[model samples]
Target: MEFVRLLLLFLHLLGMGMLVAMFFVQRRAGADAPLNKGWLHAAALQLLTGVALVGLAPLTDQEYDHAKIGVKLLVLVVIAGLVAMNVSKPKPATWLTPTLAALVVVNTGIAVFWT
Candidate 1:
């Protein structure tokens, strides 16, 4: 159970990194390029690993603040929503990438400092 928890945490962190990287990737693709699908993929990964971690907490004898988890989940949902809404478009709005990046940073800060 400990190993499983750690593994999920590792993947969750990786997903966060992927999102951060997508910011750079999107920028490099130029303003006219469509939003990258990687944003959705990374967000999905984060969502899944996050849920699994919380759902398995009892079995792992871990205690978590439900309120904090709820906030993080909400933030992730917003990120995913934004990406889904714009991914199929020819080009994302000028505010999209930076907004997403800021959300990601905000989520990280919540996870680190909310305790």
Candidate 2:
């Protein structure tokens, strides 16, 4: 189980990297550029890994602060929403990439500093 958790964590980090890279790539390429599939895949990966990680750890109100989980989950949902809204576009809105990157950073901050 720990091994699986670690693997998921690894993939989660990769997904984050992909998302951030997508933003940089988008910045370099123009709003009219076709969407990159990698960004959407990363969003999905983060969602899946994050849920699995919670299940693996099983945070309880009595033990760990579940509020942090809730907050993170909400942020993840927002990120997922962003991905869903932009995934199929031939050319995504100019705001999507930077917004996605900012949201991901916020999520990361929540994960690290929530305790």
Candidate 3:
């Protein structure tokens, strides 16, 4: 179980890194399609793996009470909402990607330090 947890964590981080890199690359290239697909896939995978880990972990109520976890979840929700909103419209890759990347980093930080 510990090994599984670690593996999930590793994959989650990898997905996040991919997302951030895709965002930056897209921003530089002035292209959105490739980055959008990559970001969507990475974000979906991260969310799935993250939820799996949380379900598998032996967490107490006190652990759930931490502000960091709440903040991270809120960020995740915002990211999801943004993704949904932008899925149909065409716009410059400015705010959403960076914000999502920042949230991913913050989520990882909270997972590492708060737990």
| RMSD from true fold, candidate 1 | 0.5
Output the worst ten-in-a-row residue range by lDDT, candidate 2: 56-65
lDDT of each: 0.97, 0.79, 0.71
Better of 1 and 3 by TM-score: 1
lDDT of 3 by residue, 6-67 (tens): 88878988988887787677677664543366666777887888777777767412224447
Alpha-carbon runs more than 4 Å astray in model 3: 31-35, 59-66, 113-115
TM-score of each: 0.98, 0.83, 0.74
Give stretches of model 2 more than 4 Å off.
58-64
> What is the clash tally of candidate 2?
0
* Tens-place lDDT digits, model 2, residues 1-115: 6577678889989888887888888788877887777777788888898777777775321234589888878887897787777778788887778878899899889878887
- lDDT per residue (tens digit) for residues 52-79 in model 1: 9999999989999999999999999999
Q: What TM-score does model 1 achieve against the real structure? A: 0.98
Residue 43 lDDT in model 3?
A: 74
Question: Which has the greatest lDDT?
Answer: 1
